[model samples]
Target: MVRVVVVDDEPMVCGFLRTILGSAADVEVVGEAYDGAAGVEAVRRSGPDVVLMDLRMPGMDGLTAIEHINRLPDPPHIVVLTTFDADQYVLRALRAGATGFLVKSTPPEELIGLVRTAARGHTVLSPSAARRLVAASTDSLSARDRAREVVASLTEREIQVLAGLGEGLSNARIAARLHLSEATVKGYVSRTLDKLGCVNRTQAGLIAHDAGIVEP
Candidate 1:
């Protein structure tokens, strides 16, 4: 089952999601919080599969929470919640490593489905959010195109390892999933990182995300 935590300053919003999420047979609402700090604490303690994060909370807003989640060993997927017109916060949240963005007014019926999709490592961006990302980060194409060109020089095995890492799989997990030895996966990961000119998995992930090649 997909476990979720909902973080919103408004108590009603939290209750509403709890009700709707309760109706999803494969999903469970594991926790709720009124601010980003409390939300971060809840995530550390509850270990939910996903977090529905509101970007406008009073203290240490959702973007801050995302940074903390990124530091975690096995972070929960985060989907920043915002009003559609709040383009600035949406982009900030995405750059902070949120897997998706959802409008606060999204129908309760669709919320659970989107949450499920995000928990499985898929990203969500509304049409307006997509447009905003394209506009705000048009420069990404130039950098992304250059990065892809460099990455294309990787050997097939290195490419596979890089793709697995882009999907957030640990080296051991990648080895088991790909039917390879752990040491081999680690070696491939090192070579892939060097070939792509990326120092860490996050940078490589950003490239993969910008290039739209790694889904789930």
Candidate 2:
């Protein structure tokens, strides 16, 4: 089973997530927290495989909680849940080690799929969130330059994989596009992450988009 924790200040939102996630036989809602501080405690106590975190909270906030959670010995993958697609902190949260972003209005089935994706150590970004991230990449010139340098180090095939990631395509789709096996595409993705020194595929995708390996 994929263990998950939902962290949102609103009790209704937490309960909503609990109900939706409960419908999936392979997913288990292990814990829930009403604030970032309590979210940290819940993570420590539950040791969930994934955390669905809200960006705005009463105390400590989601960004602060994400940083703290990432510092844990064995951190769970965190997917930020936000009300807006272009939330100002989305880029910063990704830099702070969030695995991905999901708009709060995402369909329940898609949310469940994303949670499973996070559990499997892959990044999950809603379509609108991906566009927002790519559009915001131009805001940091120095970061883009560094991303370009890192991307330049990738092999030709690896570059193709990174482009697929930037476009938010899954491993199977990437394989089909590049005419490679899924296992081979997965290997390339792993190597690309290592080369870019990224914590997750979402970060790598940001770099690829910023570096012009893929059109925004």
RMSD of each: 6.3, 2.2
- Cα shift from native, residue 190, model 1 (Å): 12
Q: Which ten residues in a row have the lowest lDDT in candidate 2?
A: 125-134
| Residue pairs clashing, model 1 | none
Give the per-residue lDDT digits (tens) of candidate 2, residues 1-216.
999999999999999999999999999999999999999999999999999999899979999999999999989999999887677687778877898888899998788898998999887775456666657655668877888889889999999999998888899999999999999999999999999888788888888777877765
> Over the stretch 40-155, how does candidate 1's per-residue lDDT look in tens digits?
99999899999999988897888898888778888888888887644766766766678778888898888888988787665565434444454566466685686578777888
lDDT to native, each model: 0.77, 0.88
Residue 95 error for model 2, in Å? 2.7
- Give the per-residue Cα lDDT of candidate 1 at 35: 93
Residue 85's lDDT in candidate 2 = 69
TM-scores of all candidate predictions against the true structure: 0.67, 0.88
